[model samples]
Target: MPGSLHNWYSLSWLDMLAERQSVLSGRIELKRLARLRDMLHAHDGSVTVNLRFGKRDGAWVIVNLECEATLALLCQRCLEPMLHTVAARVELGLVESASMASRLPEDYEPVVLEGDRLMPARLIEDELIVSLPLMPKHAHTSECGSLVRRRDESTGEAWTLDCAPPTSH
Candidate 1:
């Protein structure tokens, strides 16, 4: 209880935290989450993480995580940096083994403990990764710097700037 909740804890230790209804709430630097930072163009910001450990339906061991962050990512459409905001909420069912994962309810994502320890930081990072957009881009074409629309009257062909390279006219 005295230590930081982000630190690794034994799977068995979770029960005690759940019993006390422990909550871990803080801001985590993006650089600390290496995998997540690798996916972004700029990792200078921090994410707000709020985790609550408890039992659900009086039988299921669950941890609820809520995360919010603003990340700088390369726009797939224009090849420029764009701000992407992420707000993620995940309900994870804690299980000791992979076999137990299937037992979790549909509403809960199963998090199987590796060996005897659980890494809360890794869990938070994984959740944030999945919450990211598959293809990051500005909402409107006018917002992009390199987006261009070209029309060839002879062939009736129109070209729009995209992730693909432009072909010779």
Candidate 2:
């Protein structure tokens, strides 16, 4: 599935587990949902989540999700471009409802579906946003070097300064 249409299906718990654990790999494109955009920053990327559904704790259905992807973010410290890997594992309640406020635990955030079908794109987008880093930073350590500069003068003491443009005539 190359586009957003691939996510419009109601996958049964049993249907998800019938396939081999490793065979469920696919890319889901995220559409800009009004509700989601209001809750988090705008996002654009393919969601690569490994899925498995199984019975656990006697009677509940456990949906195990392992997701990995990279998202563009603005660094909080320097306000520069930064790309960070987003990895998360969560078990969600696969229930059908337009509003799941009552079904979810007091502390747990539920990803509810409007209808019987659970849209994979929306689910993944919500998960990614929830898993975002509080502060994003560039992966390369060298990128920080330019931000920190030093000068050593007469007294043999070192002084640190931020790399800023010099004042011109």
Candidate 3:
């Protein structure tokens, strides 16, 4: 199927999809993805996934995965629940062994297939994990519920949002 959309479970069907050059698009509930759920403040949404499968360099199998999701993450600064958006795209080269993975070019991320029954959700989750910010925070200090640094442009002084004022000598 040139342009078929289906819910996929395992990479066992990967060869058939590669042969047809299929583009699979679907939504998976965030709560259902175990690894991802553990990293979120609240897994109450879904991720939109699009995977394009085909042959690369005439012989190597490749899958281009794109995932978009809005995750509820705990803001490290304010310790509050904040919405974080992730739009991750990765080009993966499938290989059966570590030796084969070593031969792949730098451009292709090697996905060593342990078995024919690999879950696509795992791959999507991996991308999401890497795309997340190291320290999640609101874009503006006004939106954050924690003490923030404020600069005085005229005096060239800095102060905390909830700190006591300086005492004049």
Clashes of each: 0, 0, 0
lDDT of 2 by residue, 1-169 (tens): 3443245755553345433332245665444444434433336765576766554433333456778877666666655557667788876655455364465544333446556565655666777777777777666656643333323443355544445556575
- lDDT per model, in order? 0.81, 0.56, 0.78
Ranking according to TM-score, highest score first: 1, 3, 2
Candidate 3 lDDT (Cα, whole model)?
0.78
Worst 10 residues of 3 by lDDT: 1-10
Candidate with better TM-score, 2 vs 3: 3
- Residue 15 alpha-carbon offset, candidate 2, angstroms: 6.8
What ranking emerges by lDDT with the best candidate at the front? 1, 3, 2
Instruction: Report the lDDT of model 1 for residue 104.
Output: 80
**Considering only N, C-alpha and C atoms within 3 Å, which residue pairs clash in candidate 3?**
none
Per-residue error for 33 in candidate 1, Å, reads 0.8
Off by over 4 Å in 1: 1-5, 57-59, 146-169
Q: Tell me each candidate's TM-score.
A: 0.80, 0.55, 0.76
